[model samples]
Target: MEVHAIVDDLAEQLSKSGERWLHASAAKPKYFEFTPVELFAVTERMSLAEPTHELSADISHLVEFLHCVKNLKIRGARGYIGSSNVVWNALPFSLHLCKNILALWFTDCDVKMVSGLVNIRKTAKRIVVHYSMKNIEDLLLESSSIDDPNLLERWQRVEEVDFSFNDIDSIHPSIVLLKTMQRLNLSHNKIVNIGDQLQHLAFLTELDLSHNAIVHIDEWHTKLGNIKTLNLAGNKIANTHGLRRLFSLQTLDLSDNAISDIESASAVGKLPVLEKYDLRGNNVLNTIEYRTRVFEGFGERFTEIELDGRKADDREKDTVAVRLALQKAKKEREDLARLRKLQIDERIRFLSGEEHVARSV
Candidate 1:
């Protein structure tokens, strides 16, 4: 029988048993293809959740098929909770259900609901939470309690956490609890300082604090020697002097800030390994000569610079300057061509006059 048929048979058996089904049929087989360890990982994780009469019947059938299935993937679980308007207060139980989740992406979800999901701290490898500021304070407060030796052991496994587009103002003291975090994205928030609370995230490789109210990136206590991607775009930062300390940075985005002149742009251009620079929508368009000068100063260090997305007035000035330059060059070329043609005609007339004189003689 085909894999779908097999999955359908398994799903029917599971439905009859009334257990929470992973519905892995939606995920690609390659992602879920299992090795011996991976198979054991899934089974071990499933054992942690409380088995209901309904869940038990479903799980029994799924366990039988688990032997044939090489991979197990779960997808499209959006708002799986209907608006029964009943608050089940199932935080601990749901957290236990997510024990083996390797990746968790929560976008536009209510923050209050997410606080409950954090209970499965030991098993999740990566977690991305975006556009949820309402519950950030509560989430941070709860996560900070993981300082217990046993809790710290579980928290250390998380590799990446993206909390962008939230209205977070202050860096929570609890964020310091994540010791093994490799990538942290806090872009598009209202944060101002790079306080000492960040020093605890020792293994961070990619840090994005872009589009915030950040005035400076210097207050960060952690040595960013291992950081590779740093995006500080759309902030209130006026200078680039503080960024020179990030030696391992490869991609740096500082676009749409309150940059006054080319001096600030030049400072960022001088970074050792910076390959792409985005300065669009900034005050760099106040003077094109200075912008060009800064770009020239960078020489061949940068591959591309974003300059076209300036305000309408700046764009008009750039367009006028380009048109004026082209007009001047075109006029000069026309004048030179006319001069050459006049000289050729004079020589032709002289030759014709000489020939006529010789014929008359």
Candidate 2:
């Protein structure tokens, strides 16, 4: 059942029993206040009152009510009761009451209301704070420094984090402190550089930086060596030179970028394990022999890579194969012609040796 229905039923029972605290005619408390014990007492009396339909027997409703009450957090002057937002953001309750929470999300929640998250840093595994803060540094660090003792326990065991759709321009230094982070989404932000901030996250695998302002990724080889999936689509990247050392990367998204030269983009083909890449909306796609040249760069492993959301069909692969063979044949013919010219020159020199020697003398 919905949390509001449960609260309404509980409130109705309280009002019928002459509980004037929440009654319309009786004076309401200046501030909203309720405890698990008080709720339990009311539930016990309510269950006793309904002897025909025992509240204890309806474990689902009781469990639902308890779940809602557990999230009733007090934030400055206002608080939330069940699904109703009394106003403000902060921990729904005390730290002890929130010890078991596994996932926490704060969408458009003001900065002042999120100060309470420090209390449950050790408990939450998957945390999402979207469209909330402008600078991530202010949220995770003090004076832009991650060396504080108090910030050490924050995000200790978090495996996944989504700080997308914010006004973040640069990566926060404290983000590297998430030692156990595996997947991170920083897409739809204003990030410009793939800085060394994430170099130490050895456990991170998947990273989404799509739709950002990243123009150049010059030093990514050292930093993003462990990532398997990397999304750089809809950015201003011109080439894949920075991703040459991503030996572990299997999937790469470079779509909607400014890659104009096929040779410059061929840099990603050097990656040992790169299996999929998206180069759509790039200037290189308009060049003649674009796919063939790009496939040629992969050098015998072109068939293994997926380009532009599809694998090379048999016809396209045959075309690349024929082009490669023709190029090899052309090189061999050029080498043979050069050798023949040298042989003919030697014969001519042999024939003119005496004449040439006499003229020199």
Candidate 3:
């Protein structure tokens, strides 16, 4: 038998079963569980009976089936659609019919599949559209200007966006139109520079741009000052020159980067309220007296921040104290030696002057 015939037969059987259950349920107490396929059939029947009724459904199999047979219609789905873990060549046509969907889960689907999400732009509060492909700017943004009515209408209310694990090389300039956006995750992409693409998002707080090709941070104070938690792990960052301005930064993750020297890495210590940090994979981790040097560079905040993963223990604190004392002593000694040399030079000059004067007389 063909797939269509099999599906038709299963739908008929399930529909009959649903009808029998509905007629027999008033008198006797009975429990029934419906599989995804059965639920799809029964729900379709219910929708046909009452076209205006809203329903939540797990439509993973339905989406896969629609991929094979493009003409299939899913009639009554207005709330949550679980289409996760499926390889979608394109979003199924039935998804366009769901105008009031609460949350749409498209995890592990190809990025090309999101091209069909035009109808649910305003209804969906949370849309998880991540997993590998290219060029999201065309998929989401049609105009370059942030004030474009088309762009604002499409993404203004979206609060959180996760575009991780894609081949995105740069952030779309129009992402600033999401005026209500708070959290954005662009990790595991090919991004290199941030370059004012995100400066206007004043409400954005948590940003994850880890595991990319980023080298320089490009003075993030103006661009990311409102951000509270920042993750730049697994990149090619060598310096922290731009981080001193993050007055509200609380948690910072720079693990698995290319930060090589203590002077370059110590810039993170200037972040005012920084409480936690991870620098486990940087080359500076092997610097001579690394912890002590970093602790000293951080000035008075050595006791306020957590290094690697944990706060400094008694032994480490004592080591930092001893190192600081020794460093102060070394500086004092150098100053004293310099002063003595200057005095000796002055005395020698005076003796030479006196000898010359005596000879002249």
Candidate 4:
């Protein structure tokens, strides 16, 4: 069937519903000529009717139509909410329509209302809310109702959330409910601490707390055990003492912070699982020689380390080469030292004429 024909059929089926439902489905796929209200109702019905259910192939066709008509330009598992007025007003309905949505990207959408968005805690698997209508504080506060029976249960399914560029002071304790979250981006916020609330995120594997005001990373909480990637760039973390507890970490970005010397850099290197590290754009980068020395001291452990991207070349590759050369040179020096000691002992025997002075004597 033609796209428009399919939309028409869906709209006809949807109009049988009430006004609230119709208004919500109005933003349905363009293929259907139904009014926005009709489309909205269809989506509402879809959401409330099914759990653990897959949308029909026809629904996928409708998604495509919505993508074209709404100018969402989305495909595959991604949904784009860029510059769409529908996102701001029909927040709840839009989410209701995307019953099977796995990813949502809302860039530059005016999301002033919190109530409508709360319903989204259930369906979306991955969500990126950048340059949105509400700030982090407002969103966090809105989601703080632990007493809400459905809120916590729904949020647990979310795997990734990016709230970068939002004005947030601290992560609320209520966020612990998102136990399944794997990646969280809180960059460019006004946060100051790796607070006690963080202990709840046991499943978090990647955490981007960069560009914040955090001063320290506390190792007291063992809950960060599963974390593999952590970005503390542009923060006030001056040392690496607190990082020892994140034993499973493989990638760490600490560039552009207050780290002053090779000592702090070496401290990070001691991490057994650390494979990639970023020390670029920090005071440590000021001394080219010290940067080289620290990597050498760490031996052949790191696979890659950021060199501030300042050098007019492939600095990381160069550093790796230098580390290899340093290891070879150290081994050669050890061999030379052993030979010298043997030579010195032989000369002493000769000078004293103690060589086989007769077994008879």
Candidate 5:
């Protein structure tokens, strides 16, 4: 049976009993709080309350039994139990009580941030800080913004964090502290560089830093061994020097950059196992014989390559095959003609008796 169904069954049994039961919070000094592992504690966790002067008949004791709720979504609620205007950001509850909660969505609340996040450090897997002003945005994920009380402790199981379109200038170093994080989207922000701040996330696979002000190529972060799909589109990257060590990269996007020369563009060919490469909007792609030279340059190792967002179609692929075949045949024919001329010269030397003297000498 579901948890709520079990709670309903337990509540009915509590009602039939002659004994009076009160919420652990209301009883306080008179009645003792039972341990969560106890059998009676599970029944008492339900909203079944014997009549009490402190609480109404049907009031749900959040602090006493909220541990039962796995996915807790606190939406539009002004404040926590004892939250006042003076300290509106602080949620009034023992973090240990809700340690069993799996996910918490604190949305549309008065404040964007809250204190005591370190309390539920164990079971809180996903924490979404969403406050929409007609839409959601993280004004900036600066060091002071994300560095809170035991943030790394609370964000242990968090795998995805979306802090986009908030004019964030820099990636807070604490983001790299999330050892379990896999995907991070900082796109459409004001970020110019990533540096070593994001290199420590050992498990991060997909990172989107697109539409940022990453002008200089040196501003990019190296040693991201786990990143597979990187989107650095619409940046000011003029060359691909910093990307030489990203051996794990599969999909690399350098589109719309100023990488406009053959020497700068050829750096992508050294990637040991690159699959899909997007290098559109560069001057080198506009050069004459860009296709034939690039095909010879990259050596057909890249299964799919797109320059200017356009790949060679089937007919063009056939033409390239024919061109390669013809070039190979022409080279073989020249080699055979050279061998024939060498043979004829050797026969002439033998008739002139020069071959015997040369061998003896």
Candidate 6:
């Protein structure tokens, strides 16, 4: 079937399903369960069904009217009152309408925080905010306290979140509250640091933190070994020390960084399952034998390799293996030196009378 045709048919089905729920008894609750796409599309209509003015009387003025919405989307919204400035107080009541929300989308607006939307937290499965990047300094400016229920509520039952295209500078510690998050997008922002709180996203599989000002990274999460995709392109990154824990990553994007040499990305070779690596537009790309050395630097088998969008042949993998063997030999020397130092320390302790005795085997 054609793609648009499928979407049109799904729309018709959802319209009928929503109308049926208006008068149906509580006996049949199956109507509430909606597909991710259906829920996302249906959210635009789930608001209070009232004008923006009513929201100004009090933040909770529309609570009764909002009670019927199951998926709320308030896009391009501005306050209808004096200064017409929307604040954090304006969000909860807008989302509080439906007792059982499936998702909430606040796009192209001035929403600043996710602190007081707990009314929908119990049932909301997804929370998304993108663009409308005028005001988001609250969530990224200062880390919220761990006990704050409003901040914690936003992460409780959520599975995915996209806070992209906002000029965010830092990550709030409250991000750790997302116990069920599987995919996260913080791309196209001004972010520079991603603190230890990221380790809390233990269930994450795909992470996009591209188009930022990040210069360094440390592998902070102990449980994200299964993450399959990571996009760290378009940053000022020059170091690769913190990526060793993502052993399961299959697709990695480290293009458009400040790395001047292939050896600087030696960590990429440590990822056991890496399949796709993008390295172009960096200083090393202009060097002789740069393309061949990249395969060895990546240190893994892959179906495809794109250097400046130009594909390399399969023979490069074998060439890469030979290079990696040399790297291994260097590492073995370092390990042997450490072992010898341990032996010397033991002998010194024995001769100094700090340890007693020796047994001949």
Which candidate leads the pack in TM-score? 2
Ranking, lDDT, top scorer first: 2, 3, 6, 4, 1, 5
Q: What is the TM-score of each candidate against the true structure?
A: 0.58, 0.66, 0.64, 0.57, 0.57, 0.62
Residue pairs clashing in model 3 are none
Task: Give the residue spans of candidate 4 off by over 4 A.
Answer: 1-98, 108-112, 116-119, 133-151, 220-223, 296-361
Q: Give all candidate RMSDs, comma-separated.
A: 16.9, 11.2, 10.2, 11.5, 12.0, 11.0
Best by lDDT: 2
What local distance difference test score does each model get? 0.57, 0.68, 0.64, 0.59, 0.56, 0.61
Worst 10 residues of 3 by lDDT: 69-78
What TM-score would you give candidate 1 relative to the actual structure? 0.58
Worst 10 residues of 6 by lDDT: 33-42
- Model 5 segments more than 4 A misplaced: 1-112, 124-154, 219-223, 280-296, 304-311, 318-361
Clashes of 4: 11
How far in Å is the alpha carbon of 213 misplaced in model 2?
0.7
Span of 10 residues, lowest total lDDT, candidate 1: 86-95
Candidate 6, residues 1-361: lDDT per residue as tens digits?
1223333444444444544554462444322332222223223333325333322332232233245556566555344423545332343222333676667676655555333355565777776776654434444222344455334445468888788887677776556656678888889998887765666566888889999899877663453436788888999987566776777787778889987876776666666777677766578777777777766555445335554455567676666667777889999999999999999999998786743444321
Candidate 5: C-alpha lDDT: 0.56
Quick one: how many clashes does candidate 3 have?
0
Candidate 1: where are CA atoms >4 Å away? Answer: 1-93, 107-119, 133-137, 140-151, 219-225, 299-361
* Overall local distance difference test of candidate 4: 0.59
Q: What's the C-alpha lDDT at position 257 in model 5?
A: 78
| Clash count, candidate 5 | 0
